[model samples]
Target: MKILKNILKIFGILGILFFFWAAFVYFSFDKTEFLKTFQSRYSKVLYDRNGELLSVFLNQEDQWHIQAREIPQRLKIAVINYEDRNFYSHKGVDFLALLRALKNNIFLNQRTGASTISMQTIKLWDKKNRTYLNKLNEMIQSFALENHFTKEEILRLYLSNAPYGRNLVGFESAILFYFDKNPKNLTWAQAALLAVLPNQPGLIHLEKNKNLLLKKRDLLLKKLYDKKIIEKDIFELSLKEPLPHFKTHKNIAPHLALKLLSEDKKQVVSSIDKKLQIKFENKALEFAQGLKQKGIQNLAIILADTQTYKILAYVGSQDFYDLENLGQINGARAKRSEGSTLKPFLFALSIDEGLISPKSILLDVPTFFSNFNPQNANKKYYGLISAEEALQKSLNVPFVSLLQNYGYEKFFYKLKYFLDFKDEDYQKYGLSLILGTKELSLEDLTQLYLGLANYGQIADLSFLRDEPLKGLKTMFSKGSAYLTLQSMKNVQRFGLQNYDKTKIVSWKTGTSYGRKDALALGATPRYTLGVWVGNFNAQANANLYGVSIAGDLFFELLSLLDRLDLEFQMPQDLFNIKLDLMSKYRYDERLGGAYTYTLYPKEAKILRTSPFLKRIYEFQGKEVDSKDENFKDAKIQIKLDLPLNALDFLHQENLNFKSEKNIKILYPKQNLNILLARDFDKQKALVVKIANLKNEKVFWYLNQKLIYEGEATSRILDLKPKIYSLFIISESGESDEVRFEVKQ
Candidate 1:
């Protein structure tokens, strides 16, 4: 009995020790699996919205290793069947298979692998030489891994970490490298081929030993057929499919692909439309070629969905491979001079502030704003221009005046809310901010216009198709945005041909000072596009006019997008209002001017009357009105009948004088002596001419007396020989005077 008790005590001790050893092994896994570390080096890949591959960027290791988000069932099954048939049934280490392998090595004198999928996954982690100690360690970790993860996960880990030849790790990399296809679209033969590659990766080469690889793949397929995993017909057809040939990877949207590449992301399904990207890339190339002859060297374009704020197509440069022109520089993101692209925003703010309506008459004549003089592009101004026409014409004076009246600091602060201004110093830009003193990227300009298309709401553009939008904010009132877009619809187009005018396209063009940059931003109901054309070196070109070059490309791509037929829905917050033609206030017959219709903001108070009453000058039964009532008496009248080029001067003279907006008196220079022929039957009248008129009506006064008031930049004055001072005053109260003596 004592001996029996001794045996029971020894057995109890052994049993307890064994239980603890098993427990130790079960919890000994590294928790963070080896595949996680290996998968971290996956190549960053970009795919279009439709799952088309756009571009691929190699990982830091310079290897093709792309992790599969979801393993294909066929690939999973094929891998398991080929690598470890008992993968699902065994805990981790298949003891029966291990015993068979041991028996084969000892008795049959042949080496065999009995490592299950879990054991193989562990073996891949260390990549150590096969030895008894390493095998034991793998077996221990394999069993622990089974406890840590599901069987499917262990299978996935094996497929992801295993080498599939050609320095490519993971089934995804192999599928993409070998077949140039996504894993989900793999055929049975392709799956079987990839399945057996990891088994003896060193021996199977895609370029060599094709027959051996084929035999192994065929055997796997036969096994799958025998197990009834695939139908007989599929099995036979899969056998006929030839081995995949290595293909050169074609990169589409290379610039955007490089931009979106991140070290942490394995694969990114972007919002880009592959077809649209290719189409625009070609179109941009064509356009860039057309401009290259004119010394213009680069172009960029961006397109996005207005509602979703997802980037649809991005052409960062005309030719990404054109090294001579620095085509690799992504112009879409580079900050260039912003020009008049921001004018719409200023007009929108003006409408929101009730300072002006779309049809409100604004003085476009030359004016000074605290020593800063801004002139129109044509160097001439319209005396009376509607706000919409000013924006359409991209007149600098009107916009600068609007900024001055709107308050410089107010517009500066408001612009910050909509865009990220690189230079935060508001005082540096001042009133020039409305005229593009701020530099912006094509992306920045596009986002601003996209806000207008979205009815005053703005959101950051999204690249990832599945990424949720997070930064949407309101930038303008619905009424103001709608009215702003309405005014932009009829702006002149540069290169548009056979356009369908019924389709409303609201767009604006910009030309940076010095003509170094040309830009266009436009939006339809469905799409928003921004185009930039210029030299990367900032070299000014005569052809780099916003309305001509960039505007042409913008309309071309806009048509290519097939979105021209769509129109924005007018906001209900806008209503039609009648304003007097001259006063731009509530129309009344007493105002004595024709009335016109214009959309007005509902939130703004109605404009009742003209701020300044008009002054009428009546002479010779003809009347002309002046904003200033300090005009000379009508009884001292001079009949004002002026025609173009109808006067001859006694002598031609040149003058140099300082004046606002560079207005100059062309004929009768600064104090000069003029001699007329006394013997002539019909004496030539002393003629006065002016320069830089810009369609503005200038008052011709001889010695402080109004002589002519008509629509002529230069008036023909029929004057007798006399010493006289010629004073020309623009309707905006800017004046230039010169004196000359005419003697016979």
Candidate 2:
């Protein structure tokens, strides 16, 4: 008896010492370091401007934990009431509750849990076996947690780490998975449902055990009402609420959401207008479905604000899940050939250079420059057309002629230096560039159009809020951009005719070669939109072209936009002048028949001469020899009477003149080479001309063969493919010769 008493005393003293050591270690543990060493998985979230959830990127652990502040008051009350009624009052372990549980399990043969919220939080952190030793360790850790963190902080850690069935952890993830809503927005019934879920999470299937879940939830609600934590009315209403059904989360703006999520960011706030994006996405899908019936498989649309240059709505593909169409590819960012859509820029540049006015006439007849020959879209020529009319009609020949006159080098330089088109080498794109041979993305094209709408200022587009605005680059003079927009506004098409006439949209359409791509770009003073319809595989669809397909969709989108004032304000430095319709030449009505009003920048230098007289002056200056017989009677005559000031401006510029002698090559230029394909000869013919003197005879020869002798000034020659020497001899013995080659 004495030895047993001594052993008991020694054991009691050792237990007290061990308790003190554990207490010291618990108090000394760093709570922050504990949290840092613990790794809990969480999903990244994407939100739109309205704070609406766009998408959630699931982590490997399938958890979507939120911050503690995101926890709701109702949820906290429900969880505390169900899990531990005295959670706030307990110090790590509730001694009274433990005694009651021990009495029930040992003496009454009934089982009950007495683990406080802090003990459960420690258990979650350790994730160890539920043995007595582990429980003791948890008790020590729980005491440390209670000492270091506030009651609310301990509850937050417990809520964030608790498991809630179906491989989901954390209150946010479980609530979203089961109820499809945030915890803070949960109702009393929802809070009750979540409160009992963690108890038997793995064993209770929502569908199979829904009744069980409802029963447990009701009991928890009763407990809350009995304890006066919830009012009788609220408790009754929560019991009446139906069980929550599992709802799949909606992944809106999936492409953009995934793109932003890929940047490894925890949260992303985009500038997208959710309503507009949804509307445009539906429209794009419907349009693409309709086109698919006609063998077209893909489409994209982008709408941006001209003032801020921020993308408001973007549909990167018609259906991102359509594997057959390769729909995962973002068509808006893909590069493709740009057809006649770029013609307006070319005309704008020419206007800025003071090379041509809107009324300047361009030859639309069959013509060739070097080895290249261009044709109009309709395969028929209008002989001669004004620059403005050609652009409105989208005439190919007129634009090609203008590009030739403007020079390819200058246009290439402007596109590279001014705009940031750095993808293609300059040499790869040729004279066919005016016809849309150069490749460009829809984003690039939209930016260019936005520049035109913003009075020739180009700025980079933004996709996020509070992003720094890009520096503005000048693309065209204000006057030139205005003129281009004016021309585009008058474009004749089915889409434009159907829209509200009061709202002006300066727009252009492009159809790439073989109809592989269809594009339409439109801009108002407030907004800019661009759309493309094509196959991602670069397959051609004959029925799909810009005017009938892309243009129609563009107009439909325009109708959905809110009305804004689109009136253009003319700059103070621009002036209007009258021009002859037939000749496209500036004429004073005081000395002329009829004319149309045309706008020109005040700084622009206009040529003061008739088109006919200008042509004759150029011929005389270049081809007429002073010692030749044709020069003896070559005297310039002023035919039209003019105003004194106009005459003075003309005389100062040395442009008011009409030459009597017209000695020049009208067809083949000096040292020119021509390719003679089988089809080329049918579309084009060679003609030769010499100045006609009074009863003077002219002789023409090809390769020393006297082809004709005529008194007429012009003669058409039927020459075959060969190197030929053509000689023209006047009756006065003045001779000129040209050597040229034609190849098959």
The CA lDDT of each predicted structure is 0.79, 0.75
- Model 2 superposed RMSD (Cα): 7.8
TM-score of model 1 (CA atoms): 0.79
Task: Mark the regions of model 2 whose C-alpha exceeds 4 Å error after superposition.
Answer: 1-40, 61-164, 167-185, 222-234, 356-363, 405-407, 417-424, 495-503, 564-744
For residues 623-654, write the lDDT of model 2, one tens digit per residue: 45466667665654224433222233333345
Candidate 1 local accuracy as lDDT?
Answer: 0.79
* TM per prediction: 0.79, 0.74
Worst 10 residues of 1 by lDDT: 642-651
Tell me the lDDT of model 1 at 392.
90
Per-residue alpha-carbon lDDT of model 1 for 1-744, expressed as tens digits?
A: 999999999999998986787677657666765556666767788889988778876777777776666798889889888988888889999999999999999999999889988888888876889998788778887888888889877877777778887768888778777888767898999999988888888888688788999999999999999999999999999999998876667678888888888766667899999999999999998988889889899999999988899999998899998999999999999999889999998888777777788777666654545436588888976665788999898999889988988888888877677675655688998999888887889988898999989878988888889989967888778888988898899898756657666667899999999999999999988889999999999998887889888888887787686757876788888888887666475665564546687777787656455442343466555454454354354433222121111111101112222122434566676777777554354554554556543446777788999888765655655656878898887777767788778776
- Report the error of model 1 at residue 341, Å: 0.8
